[model samples]
Target: MKKVLLLLMIVIAVSCKNETKKEVKKENIIEVDKNYFPTELGKVFEKHGGINTWRKVQILSFNKGEEVHTVDLQSRRTVINTPKYSLGFNGKEVWLDEEVAGTYKGNSAFYYNLYFYFYAMPFVLADNGIIYEKIDALVFEGVKYPGYKISYKANVGNSSDDNYMIYYNSETYQMEWLKYTVTFNSKETSNKFNIIRYNKWKNVNGLILPSEITWYKKDENGLPTAPEESATKFTLPLISQVKLADSFFEKPKN
Candidate 1:
């Protein structure tokens, strides 16, 4: 009886030791996988250019259906700069030119430029705004993309009326496209504006910038209407004559 009892205690000790060892091994495996999390790609995007860099841009808008209006947009310090100045004009008359002393009043084109500027900073901004989920994996233009689907509630008073879902390209660590509906004060709602592709990634002072961006806009039924439009083009001059002032973006008060 005594011998049997001693054998039972020994077996129990051995079983407990094996269980502890297995648990430690499992934890180590989880740690290794965590290192490959997709959010880390934001650091890569930042290394290229990211959203932190400030730049001046020219935005050209064309009427998709009719040939009535075409506009030029001049913006300074798209992201960080506050009280941003934008000058706009339809091909013929002055639509919006708030920068100059004798310019026109506010209009829809002015509001459009403002919305574009806010979307300049992609990943970091989204992380702060809402929840993100890993969506799928995709490849574009020979680049691999591990996709992440993001959903968030917009801030009160934002033009984006509904909750938004944006898909981020994993390999590039940038947002490829997003879908959302917007409500304007005019009581009109449109579900247009989808980013299709990012082209011409150029390095500006160690920051990779997509000089050309294309997106889609569809009508209510979601039919492919117009071939997407290239949103903006930034031409960085090798040498410049005019000195850029720190207060360039500030609105000159009357």
Candidate 2:
């Protein structure tokens, strides 16, 4: 009788342990499913209309490295006002403010005159179907951000250098920083665009916008400092309407 009772008690204990383990497993699976995975960012981009199209942007830019230079520019500052042309600027330089004149002169000037076209990938990622790679998490100002490294590649006939990486904050889903490499005359130069720790996202014409932006180059410490080469800020106006022709995206004639 004693032997039988001991065996029964052992069996009961084993069964109860197994049931507890199963419950723990079930809870773990639920937690995994509940996580805000990086894939959800793709959905957010889709909901925001997939990048290539954004109207009315306001940007405040700053330079990194030696001295922190700043600018306050608006998009409507360079309105061409012609049926075919319009121009925009960021205080220091013109971004895209041109009307399709008899020739594609403004288009050419916009590309070669300023690096605006080269640096437009951050904004174009939504419309051009940008791809994201999971990178390390970024911790800033006491907040831990799940980071997704972002990049873009050009399609047929688009010579714009779209190869660059951007870091999106995990919690806010806002772009926190960008790292890019550009080749000039066979020499590759790397740059980082850093956010100076601020909240307050602005919505512009159905799209979200980051009001402040700063540029920096990665340093030996693996942290962001001010960028020395070229930096500027843009303050966009309230753009109620935009009428860009198809030719605006084409390359200018030689």
- How many clashing residue pairs, candidate 2? 19
Q: Write the per-residue lDDT of candidate 2 for residues 1-254, one digit (tens) a residue.
A: 22223333543464466500111122222111233224545444433433433423332221122211111123322222223433433334444333444533545224332333322323444333454455555544565555444444545113344344445556545655555544433333334333333223445455555444556544564555555444344333232222233232232333
lDDT of 1 by residue, 166-189 (tens): 445555555554444445554344
In angstroms, give how far residue 203 of model 1 lies from its true place.
1.6
lDDT of each: 0.37, 0.38
Question: For model 1, how many clashes?
Answer: 2
Measured on C-alpha atoms, candidate 2 has an lDDT of 0.38
After TM-score superposition, the amount by which residue 72's alpha carbon in candidate 2 deviates from its true location, in angstroms, is 22
Q: How good is model 2 by TM-score?
A: 0.44
